[model samples]
Target: MGTEARRAGRRDFAGLWASYGLSNLGDGLVVIMLPLTALTLTSSPGLVAGVRWAQTMPYVLCTLAIGVLIDRVERSRLIRWAHLARVVALVLFALALSGEVAPLVALYTVAFLLGTAELVADLGTTSVLPMMVERNRLDGANSRLESTRSSLNEFVGPPLGGFLVAVGTVFATLSTAGLYLVAAGALLLLGRRYDPRPAGESAPAAKPRIRDELTEGLRYLRGHRLLRNLALMVCVMAAAWSGWSAVLVLYAVSPGPMGLSGTTYGILLTALALGGVLGSLVAGPVRRLLGTRNLLAVDVITGVIMLATPVFTAQPWPVGAATFLGGVGSGLWNVTVVTLRQQLIPDELLGRVSSASRLIGWGGMPLGAAVAGVLAQTVGPRPVFALGAVACAALLIPFLRVIREDTIRAAVASRDTRGE
Candidate 1:
């Protein structure tokens, strides 16, 4: 197709987003289901954390390589192959369950492979967005994508997984595997076209040096004052959030002073999910009105609201309420930062740069969760949350100094003028 023709229709972009939205919902279900299945079989917190490692390890280890792959290959073809691999992994899980294999090892292996595919698929999917929309429309388009991901994956995925777990562990994994197959089918239906790359316009040269590519992506992020600060702030916050996630299931199921039971825990999950949905829906408008700086200022307030979760340390209702408000803040933070990143970063470096940025921002999460798990084992869950909250709050002080109006505008304008 001609360049003009490729840019003409919104139909393909709409379909692409729709398919991704559906796929992510399934992805969320898979995320929740794996942990629950492990809990059912092994009943070990570390094992559960280990499952998370299985999922995240690929992102940590393979991200730079995936970025290279995304830039080198056709994004749509890459997505298609990635989804196909996901189907195979899901099928492998089904076979393991059918054959009555040990759920832990089988699921762990599946999670590892699934994470590898997800790394590529996610890079391809997100990197292609800048190409899909007109330059002026990028913010709205990115906002829509973030909203879809937050609402479905973060909000809807957990509760659905828990509900399925309540039904039965094996049944839940099987059901989630089925969802993956459905997502695969959706990807097949979605058209296999993508935005053109600047590098691909000319004859492909020798692939850039890996170290050069990696450092270049980092340099770009560091060059932007806001990006550098935001990335650091998120890394710290991720440590806290990962702690909260590690103990959340345990907290809900505890019989002590502030614990909730099975179905009641599901209710809490549902509330958290609803809060995320509401937060995501409001993100774009909030960013527009507040602009980036004020939006982050609001994020700081929400962080305090999140710290209130400890106030509910003795009751489920208060915990649920705190979680609701925290969800809103987190939702807004994610949408704002993501939109800013898309607006600031160049499309040519979208994959590598995003992967590198994520390395600093998200790379610590699995480690955080692991650390929280060990600490929780010795120190108790409540202390972990309290300490994490205080630490996260302390970390934000530097961020306030880093994120200024000028920095935000410069970051936004960099992409704006470039038509990214």
Candidate 2:
């Protein structure tokens, strides 16, 4: 297709936004319900974390390949297919739950498929966004998207997911399935030809090998010092968060430390989302007043607050408050870093480079989850939180040394000079 043809009849952002919202709403249900379902099947910390790891490990193993795929094809078709696959997987699992046949294996099977589909769909969304909006407006656009993620997935979804699961786990699972189907339908209405190639880039008559494409992305990201440091910092943070999150349900549920009911546990997740909502609301102003480096710094402090509070107290409210702050940290991190990446990376390479960067950032989460299960099983969940806090704190030294006001400015400046 010609460049003019690609630019004509472009994908609608409003339609895309609506689909994104509905998709994440489904994810919110899955995020809470899956772990809760595993708890019903088995109480072993290792097993529970193992299930969680199953869902997220695709980001580690499959992200790099998905990134290359995004750069090569039209993203709308990719996302539509991903959503449909999720619907099928979710419906099967819901049926298994309703029939009382959902073993641990069933949960793992559904989780792995869901994780893979989610990676493709979510990356497609991020990769196409630069085509829809200008660079100067990326921060605002990303903040809105981040807030949608935080709200539906964390705030509205968790409490609702909890309530639905409390009423009937099968129903909750079915509802999530329904949402994915509807989300897929929304994308279908937008049509299938949302080619994401940047202006002036022609399609290759024959596609390059995935391995070659992936190497190009990795080489670009590796050569960029500022992004390299930022990605590394996120890797550390994600690993620590993974360790604490692996066995969190066991830490808070009945006969556990906090003694909260399943429904109330969802409410606790809501508290964390509450912070994210507030943080998203303020991130624009904070970024304007404080700038990017300082905005990024907030996450480390919030990380300590979140991971340490559980160690010092067995109270649910304290953990809730800590998560609220952590949510703020998350909001700040997403707005600053995503915007930075969008501005800096060229449109053609955005999918591959961003995915490669995420490979670096989230690659350790599965490992952390595996280790966390063992630690929680052996020493108890409380010690896992303490260790997570220590690990989160340890990032400060490298973070301070690498990411600074000058480095942030220099990165953007270099991009402008190159006219990327």
Candidate 3:
């Protein structure tokens, strides 16, 4: 409300954003190096891919419990703890690599620890923003955060991580650990006022048992028609994207249709990140110009084009262009949907609600990938893309009908009316 408060808020938000970027950079390094490290020690494809399996498994297993913890604990501390956990995990892994007995199974445990920490950090970051900044700036703030994530985590970190591994695994792992430690320190520097728990929690009655609170959060998301629909939209979109992504290497690499070299395949993936960067930069202005409804529809349309492109053409460039567009749509969707949920969800319910939504959304990815693998094996990679395109296209009309702009405006108005 006062000038000093504004300055303090800005200072705290800066800390959060800086920590977020550094943490993402650390995560990106681990994501790449973990898999590549597994490959060095194991020749079995399943065991090699099991590294990714270990990392991602926590989203399915730990999200709700982590969500409850975020709502219960001070957010910054939770985030800082998560970062510290990664630091320990990475450092231990690094030390293990120096020994002759760095077992592949042990790597899976480290991956799990890193993933669980990531889940906490990500949910904490999302739920903490509304407390730190003015509501008017949420869209812009989210856009900037998304851009930073795409730029550092997806585009820059993987290649850099690869280079680090080539230098030495111990060096790369230790360096990633350093990034997480610095990220933890960033949050520790923020003032105490920025670290308060959810509002309206002073009253004893407002605090429920953990199980009850988790259930209430789930019910809140399920009961709200708009939020429920939005979550489903995200779930379906994630499935479609994952479906194509599962088989993309088959469609793109040498001896596949596109005939891309290993280096070119990486570059093609970077094109998607490039689009995410541009999309995040433009999201605020585009939301103002086209409005939410049209922008969301664009997300679905891009999904179709992205999946269908490989089916229609054997050229890497065209598929690269399509994936880039898909990334743009993703950037736009993320800023819009996340900002919407933040504004509309009660602050106390924000953590649980967001985690529930993500659970529904990300729950589809593994399934999509699994199904795509089977389908690709049976009918070939091209047919898998076609099936994914069809699934994505099916969402268009329903999304438009249910997600009218006025419904969202009414939801925001209701939240304000309730003084939530």
Highest lDDT scorer: 2
lDDT of 3 by residue, 305-413 (tens): 9989988898877888898898898888888888998999877778898888877877676566666767766677787788889888999878878999898889889
lDDT per model, in order? 0.70, 0.85, 0.80
Q: Order the candidates by lDDT, highest first.
A: 2, 3, 1
Measured with C-alpha atoms, the lDDT of residue 233 in candidate 3 is 82
Error of model 2, residue 226, in angstroms: 1.0
How close to the true structure is residue 370 of candidate 3, measured as C-alpha lDDT? 63
CA RMSD of each candidate after superposition: 2.8, 2.6, 2.7
* Model 2 poorest 10 in a row by lDDT: 1-10
- Candidate 3 ranges beyond 4 A from true positions: 41-50, 96-103, 193-207, 246-264, 373-384
lDDT of 2 by residue, 1-420 (tens): 345534432446666778899999999988789888888889788898887789879978899899998888888889888999999998888778777784678899999999999989888888877777666767777888889888998999988888888878788888999999999888766643657676567887988777899898899999999888888888888878888777888899888889988888888999778888778867889988988888888889998899899999978878899999999998888877888888888878888999988899988788778888888888888888888899889888888888899889998998889894
- Comparing 1 and 2 by TM-score, which wins? 2
Q: Against the true structure, whose TM-score is highest?
A: 2
Model 2 misplaced regions, further than 4 Å: 1-11, 99-102, 189-192
- In order of appearance, the predictions have TM-scores of 0.90, 0.95, 0.90
- Give the local distance difference test score of model 2: 0.85
- Supply candidate 1's per-residue lDDT for 322: 76
Give every collision pair in model 3.
none
